[model samples]
Target: MKLSKKSMTVLSFTLGACLFVSTAFADTLLGSGYDRLKDSAKNTATLMEKDLKNYTVEALYSLKDNDQTLLQASTFAKMDTVNQLSEENTVTKTAKGETTSSYSYSDKKLSVRKSGMDNTYYVTEYPADVNRKGPAEFSNPFKENGAAEIEKIVDAVVGSLKDYVQVEEGTDGGKVYSGSLSEAQVPAVVNAVSSFGIKQMLHDERDLPKIESDIFVKKVVGTAVENKAGYLENVTGDITLSGKDKNGVQHDLSLNVIVKLSEVGNTKIAMPDLTSAKVEKVSYSGGFSSKYVGTYKNDIIMDKDGKFEKIGERTVVITSVEGDKVTGKYSETVYPGFESEYPNKDAFNFEYNPATSSTFTYTDAKGEQKNGTIHPNSAGKVYFEMNIEVIDKNSWKSSSLKPYYDGEFRRIFE
Candidate 1:
């Protein structure tokens, strides 16, 4: 397994599935004990999938070198999938006694962030009709795979290091699994962590520990527990590294992590009261191109006789932009059947990612996500277009594709 990608579920020290273990430990030695543990993991994953919504996750990370504590950091987070709300608070202290912290909260309409440096809270208000994302999903502390990530890694590590890892009964009728890694077996793990894990976890890459070519991993041990609901509730790991630098200077490094999940499906996001807090409220375009924040309409259609029967109008309204996402509405009202395909005044969002050819993901009136783009033509004229091949293949509302809607869109309002 590519440990860097998969084992990132938890701390570098807690992740051992990345290590290639040659010993085939006895699965029969513990008989049903092993099967029971495996069953617990499976059940826990199911529980997370079915009932995992609002929850709180706490992860504590500490790095030390011999008598010197290099870094201590903690991250506490709550997520409410139903309301599409989440909040995370992180605090980090360095060896020099310098501390930095930040808290960020996001709901359906607003994204608020507070920093410790100047006690400033930056608030970005989204546009009207913005809809929430998901209802019930659990992800990593960084919102990756969810706390269940630790469960999967633990199961894999235990399976590989059957000889080294042991399992016992947990207090709440859950299970406790522990394992150890020797120095020779931990270099790959530690190196991957230094090269990838630390960078991914720490908000500032400069805080990463300085390690030279010469390396040593003295010890690495971790424990994982399943809660009463069979969910992977907590994980703790400790790692020690001792080695000589190029100049033969002895250095000892230590890393520790404690990760816990609680209040599954009941955790609520307490939106910080900004009434008395230092806040900076600003109204800014929230998309790849703020200039797209306007209404664009195609020319009125003319019949063959050059006389307007029922004018065909295709209008695209980009109402608001915030952080690479734009909320707006699009409608095609072609004559003969002037009833329009999309509903009026309904808002949808598109992730404005210009790197991929300035493409965006916009959901149609039918609630299907489609690729769309809003850009300036060679004439510096902004135009909007969407690929409805999926909509066409599935069920197109129009009698046929209207070319005007896909053609030039002239800005009519801002």
Candidate 2:
């Protein structure tokens, strides 16, 4: 599965948040107590690397605007690496059963099928083809020694952060930790993450953007519960990022994650057979070009016009789709002046680089990409549901307008 930039950012945040707990380990954690925690983590890592382990995790992620839930979702995943197989299910509250996905993964390939909805099966090679193989492969942290390397980095980061953290025992026999690192403590974490000898597990060194002084973790809080056998039962945590976007809008991005593990050692995982499955080589072509238009009411009130617009219209143009490469353009124009009942207003063009435009990968309710016509109708239409980060070059500050367009383009010509 190819993660988009936003998804990658979330994954990076999860990895960075894991570093917070280590800060406490390097300092205020007691002698024997620290060893126990460290040993527990290490033992779990070793077992996962040597034996078989299964996990059932439920995660809820939300993005809010003015305390209102702009987006919220719950995900449940069951994975057993013994036979190298796993599956996941997800549901969103707003859409309820309307949008849900199921995924199955094996060592050699991955298959996705929409649950409670469609029949199209989206399949692809498991570990994407890359130059590196085995231990050297940097793609897919869930594969190879990737998991172990992350554990190593976590252990090392915790060990070296001793001087910068504070820890306390949880009331229920678990552990609680929190801290904000100083400028000098940042490198310790970096060095620790690099010490694992698994370079670029999270990101390539050269590709990593330069860190600013203000980019340090403002605050981190976490808790972990483990068994006497040095195995973790549950871990939960939240991290907050305080910063401003390119548009000068100050915002706080908060992420919460929960993990649970069980059935360690010699677990069985059954692999699925592709022989009987409806499998097709996914493909898109230029002949699929199309154009479409739709209309809606304008909700925004402009200052200069001091009027409520009656109508707003959107247009989409798909110039071409060559081979697996698809090209398209989108624009939404709103009549800011007096009532146009007929959408009689100036046209505001929102431009985007088609090459840079994110591909609109269609998945079933199960979230599996499949091969078929863009829309489920005879219209032969292409659709897009994307958050295109467009800048208003018409303005001096080049203000960012991350507009989201969800529409379909139907072929107007042959």
Candidate 3:
């Protein structure tokens, strides 16, 4: 009998009857069992038919060129059994960064292109010649496994649709529709429709330029069961883009997503200490000095009792002192070469001795070494002597030497 494709229930029962009869004689004593098996098969087929009619599937497809570059793409379609048999279907393609293209199908053939490119086109034929190799018995769509076969048709449509449209956006912001399908089918339907609308907008080229957006978690609140408080947790950030169409319009085109995050579940507070402060002092030291020299008319110049007259004295003073050291400036003037044939008649040397409380030494500039003790004066300041040496007579070349000029001193605390 020629069968109607819409009456899958009747066809499934007929097939089940044939199977039961073929197995009836082998289980003559179990005739009821065979009958039960037939009933079960019929029920399963009925449920499948119901499912096929009610199920709405949405899918996205991307079309690419032979070089694997994207050419055009479409948003997901909401397909069901009612519209499954038409040789032609309507699909929307939203190109990345451009306009959207709406297509019309017919005669088991699909064609789509930019709006004005009508005379020239790209096409795909259905019942694809390569897939038609089955036997005559399997050719009848109704006599075959209806629900499973229908699913294959849905898959093929989704696959073809991909070759034309591209997804420009994806989001988890909408409500989730979940539960026993029979109990929550209404909400599920609403969710499916809303999602399909989003997909449509994404696929439409005119909507491309309006697709950029940013999302962030605004605030967080926590509850505590005991006498304590809960702290805010790590927050995350996101950025998204809607794809474009051929006209450079962004549609359902979504690309470039970024998520920002921070460390989670850490809560501690820090405080400062205020009870351990104290006062302290620090000292530092430094200083500078000056000095001069004079020469005798003769080394043995007579005094009151034929004693040698002392004609010169040299001195130095610490100009400044700071911690353990003293700094001073000094200068010396002298007659050069008094007793020798060096050049000038004013040459001489000066020296000092702490044990004798006087500055005295030899007169030869190149032969004598002068030494002196540095002592503090009554004002709690320190001073030392500088020695002068005369090396020439005619031109009177003299050199000034300050004893312990750049020297360091230390204080011993008993």
Candidate 4:
């Protein structure tokens, strides 16, 4: 950001005046430190009573934050003092002064100057209008009452100045000065001088134009996936301006607007192939079981399109095996079953392994031991049959059993 020469001049003067006026009123004006000088200047500007067409003073002052000088907060003080000499003189003399000073605040540099003065000893700090080329032009000096009218003008200007020169919290969690005069304040000062009640003296001044502008923004983006069993696919994007302000000459400001979009729009995902998977055991039964009870486990592999190409082989070892109510562990390699019956198929297949054959010994009613073989005919078919017979037990009979399988699976797209 760049500032125009006129704006720079006004800002410099404003800062200089603030420092000078704040320092002049100190008890030991000649040998006072910066702090004492500021105090004296403010006191003198507060007390001095004089009547002149126009009066101005400028000063430069340093600001400190946590005992450290802040360079950015440093500014010039420029004040325009106006007084109604007499009603008899439509023409009023203008007195102005300029001062340059520097202050380091928080290790930053702030510089300002003060310019423009009038005959009146009372100071009138008007807001600078960047639009206008020169100082505000007034037609006449105002004079109605003796001291009261002059006092009001002085008070207004001083009050505004006092409010303007203080430090405030900055957006960056730092300290800043509120010394810049607003466009309205600039004209108000001029109006105050022209409206003085002393009918003998009258003055009219037009305010200069000042302008300020800024920009900001907020945005949000998110994505959701549905019916994806084990796969997780989510995407999100974001952009923000963060509310930044640009101050200075409007014309000198050049913004390079840049918008970069890496990715946008709908994404394509493939569904996992879930078909032809079989279930082995449902509950504790001697033959092929339909009721898949207890706990089971299986592995499934998916492709880029989220479709399953191959299901890993699993093996379930029965830790304990009983009689007609057989108990043991079952493990199997499961392929992608139909998407609709995934969970059921997945659960059933986990109970039995189609790739391996198992032989178990069971006790019959007569206390004789019987042997039986359990085998899976299909790799992942939904339903399969198994044959079981008591080979060594005389009283035990042979039984053929068919197991029904059911389970589910889900696909994730990224």
TM-score for every candidate vs. truth? Answer: 0.54, 0.45, 0.16, 0.13
The residue-by-residue lDDT of candidate 3 on 109-194, one tens digit each, is: 22222122233232333334322111101122233434456434333323322222111111332111111111122122223322
Residue range 58-120, candidate 2, lDDT tens digits = 676653322444345667655565444556667654312234454544343444444434454
Per-model lDDT: 0.55, 0.42, 0.26, 0.26
Candidate 2 backbone collisions, by pair? 22-158, 26-162, 27-162, 100-365, 101-366, 114-366, 285-321, 286-321
Q: RMSD in angstroms, all models?
A: 16.9, 13.1, 48.8, 40.7
Off by over 4 Å in 1: 1-14, 18-29, 32-50, 128-160, 181-214, 283-414
Q: How well is each residue in 20-82 modelled by candidate 1, as lDDT tens digits?
A: 221123233343444455565456555554457677889998877676887788999887766
CA shift of 212, model 1, Å: 4.2
Per-residue error at 251 for model 4, in Å? 20
Alpha-carbon runs more than 4 Å astray in model 2: 1-29, 32-43, 65-73, 92-100, 105-112, 121-218, 245-248, 265-414
Give the C-alpha lDDT of model 2: 0.42
Residue 248 CA displacement from its true place in model 2, Å = 4.7
Compute the lDDT for candidate 4: 0.26
Whole-model alpha-carbon lDDT for candidate 3: 0.26
The runs of at least 3 residues in candidate 3 whose Cα sits more than 4 Å from the true structure, single-residue gaps closed, are 1-50, 53-97, 100-116, 119-130, 133-414
Q: Which structure among the candidates has the greatest TM-score?
A: 1
